[model samples]
Target: MSPHFPSMAEPGGRTLGDEEVAAAERVIRSGMLSAVWGTEARALEREMAELYGRRHAIACSSGTAALHLAVVAAAPDPGDEIITTPITDFGTVAPILAQNAVPVFADVDPETGNLDPAAVARLIGPRTRAIMAVHLFGAPAPVDELRALADEHGLVLLEDCAQAWLTELPPLPPRPATPLAAVPRPAAPLAAAPPGDAGVRLAGTAGAVGCFSLQQWKHVTCGDGGLVITDDDALARTMRLFSDKGWDRAAGRSHASFGLNYRMTELQAAVARAQLAKLPGVVEARRRTAVRLLEELGGLDGVRLPRPEGHAWWLFPLVLPGGGAREMAAALAGEGIPARAGYLEQPLNRAPVWSGPVYGTSRFPLDGADAGRGPTAACPEAERLVADTLLVIDWNENYTDAHVTAVADAIRKYRPRP
Candidate 1:
């Protein structure tokens, strides 16, 4: 009875169907391959923006580029520090560096793996310009608290919505009665708030801007592309110029500032347009599959499955109880599943790249100016998660119940070799 056979299965490989192929082919035939005001890209942006309750959406080359543009559009001054979670894709951090802004790493909550606002508040300083909250693994961060914190401190709030496109978070609850025995509950929805108004709002609409990824592996695949959604018309226009090499499309001339060519190809846009149409279905499938997996993995000792929420479930992350994420990953790999432990490195702050002159550590005034500051001091919770996390293979609209069961059973049977 080799559990390996059952455990090693994956969701079926994804492919573009007839409609997608037609869209791509149409773009190929049109010869308007580069960025242009076309129906396809426009429609895609409109649809996605509407989907996320955003006023505008600007499609870009990749998620990283979208983040960079969003940071730039938010207009944080050079050398300003942006507080962000360490538990995220480097793309989320790279954009901060690209703007010459320092990324002050704030730790995330161990359970949700999202930026902890309390941790962020502790780390905020004079130069804190913005808070880039990444909704890790499709769970929306506590955006409302982050928003209030941003308002209190006069900081910009930007969302890395690449993981969470259409997810809505429950509101934070109100404080309990201290002296009194109990307080009467508020009306229906209001009563559900978390204690101390700690709940987060949805990423895009709540924050100043939200960014999304349509990378091939994401629930919606546009081959490789990203988008920035903002309610600020002026910022949206500026970002358009930034994406188009500082060219003011209206004037048909180059602007003063040097901007990068972060435009998305029409081909990608066309494909994205079609994909956006299917996002709801794709997201639903991933959610259904994840629900099944969570149920199957329930109550398994030494395995911490992610809690279900109104999340998109990008990656199925499991935290091994006995501190054997690496060994568990290896055991799963030996069984032929595409499982892997968390990042090989510690906090990005500790990475060699950050220590060098390239990251401007010598030039900037971080709290620990001389000592290389790591999340160990600032973000103990995130550090713990980084050490204990493991990932299972996931994709858009590809998973089945059988696949979910297999992954759960694999986790149940995994035993680290001594």
Candidate 2:
């Protein structure tokens, strides 16, 4: 019989245990569940800030909420644009729409499925307010190049790190010889590489704000929670206020600005703290197994393997450059291995939501000549990836060498024969 593969949806595939249970009990015993009056959430923020070496961290209710907070920090005016990859979760684009900003879908690199800096640079125009980059499937996006591009254009750069925990970014390349003009405002300093992270930058640190998720399927979880890290005091304060209905608690009973109730509850915070302690181990195990699979499949034909360097291996992605990813996925599944083709049904630019009214019967921000106007860009690379080349196997820290071998054997058996 084929060996059973573990999945993130089940307990056996997760890291939760007595520690998380005890954390929940501690919060319940405290008799304070709301973050407004509880210490757990605040403590989580402190720990997150210290971990990422950021000056501040704000805990929120969900990964989407964290991205929304980052959007608020960017302060995009109605109809301004945020350039991002089409290959990411809708959560990445939702915040841009929530703030009445048009999302410009940029093409991705064929291999890495990351936003191509050249594609993003082409999309930037007078109305562009920010650049939100996602480290898709835990592989570091070309943020250093994106950062330089953002700096040259004076755009706010937001990193959606929902899928990347402890994913390290490569060093910044040498600056160009061309003399670029100064930005409208000084850019915030990137977070210093953490101890033992010598010579490499962390994924979320290059941008103005880095957003992380604590959803159940992530490397670590508190059911559903989020954290945002930043060095800019003003941006941190703005996000904190926005997450709490714009109430500046220090200022007596007055609503300070437009905001939402995105605060993380004390219970969630407590559990997340327990999970946080186990993050390094979780990522390390995932890396170890993912690299092993990469090594085993290194010489396979008609397929492209994901580069293992600094990847947190959220999902093991493979590209069938010669096509037939769907059939290969089916064959692997028939053998009891978990795999799927086309991470999304379609890229966001081609999503059905765009063809309909965006805001209660009006396309407001998406209506004008310069507006997004539903599937405007070709994004051919992203389209081809979703329709033909991409395949992802469910991955988790619980995967063993035997599990890796099973997957490798299955792939070797069913890969498209040249």
Candidate 3:
């Protein structure tokens, strides 16, 4: 028999239930598979909007498409530099290129893996137009600070909450830090509770725009879909129109500008709507398991896990700054635990498209002369974090305390001796 552990909780497997299956079946029976103008797509939008306490949530084909729509709506200028973290999926930066913009990398917090606002502040230049703060691995970046900085610098603050569905930054005067599982939560209607009550707000609600992924591996999945949440009505309309080929539904179906077909199907929307009601449970499960792991593993030599409070625990990322991520991962694998070193092998700036010629040697975005100057070294901390020390294990809504213990045991098994 193979020594590798069985995959525990993939997004689709853990979250997909009777409601999701029934939702899809109902959509199939409805005879209206596509909701180009109405039905489930619209319902999902309203549901997600209300859930996050946002005024608008626009549905789209993919997370990348949602981000692209955000870029198209808030930043349309070519060569505009968007300051973002290097420790993120390409979906975060791909949209910048789609908008003919330059993506500038800012270093990340070694602890949380979220964008370091100070690094972002330093990276801001004359051409810089926006700061895209990714809630990396479900831990929120200092978004309120990023927002204030954006206002101070006249730059847009965009929150990429693709992996951070229910993650929130606690209200000011955060209570004495407690494990996420022990934090007293108001019973029932968690989504309906206003941010003022808990002095806490969801990660995506603070920025000029927020993008979420409902991809297969994300916290929630509609097979493959995306949602754009924003408080600005004009911005929401722009995003909606942009995703719908610039055809403003309110404007008698007239095309307003150049756009793309990034519409989500009604089938996907039906599943997403059903999935929304269960998101609180999804987040709770991951948070509880994550908190337990932190409690057990905290203070372990050569291992660093971010604070459990306010983190969504999308993936249980750990940093071994002493540097044995890959070897540790392999050891964990041998012990019937799953893990991998580095979320992404390198920063976004080092991606081939960044330094490579744009078209026939005309590299307008990276550099007019040499595309090699794409700023890969802009975030050395992120490079080292990924290349030399980061390792992550799957975290999901189905993980239990036992699973947490197993993971912790595997990590300690491979813990490097001082």
Task: Compare candidates 1 and 3 on TM-score and give the better one.
Answer: 3
Predicted candidate 2 versus true structure: per-residue lDDT over 15-89, tens digit per residue = 999999999999899899999999999999999888887899999999999999999999999989889989988
RMSD of each: 6.4, 4.1, 6.2
Best by TM-score: 2
TM-scores of the models, in the order given: 0.84, 0.94, 0.90
Clashes found in each candidate (C-alpha, N, C closer than 3 A): 7, 0, 1
TM-score of 2: 0.94
lDDT at 22, model 3: 97
For model 2, the stretches where C-alpha displacement exceeds 4 angstroms are 173-193, 369-375
What's the alpha carbon RMSD for model 1? 6.4
Ranking by TM-score: 2, 3, 1
Best by lDDT: 2
The TM-score, computed over Cα atoms with residue i paired to residue i, of candidate 1 is 0.84
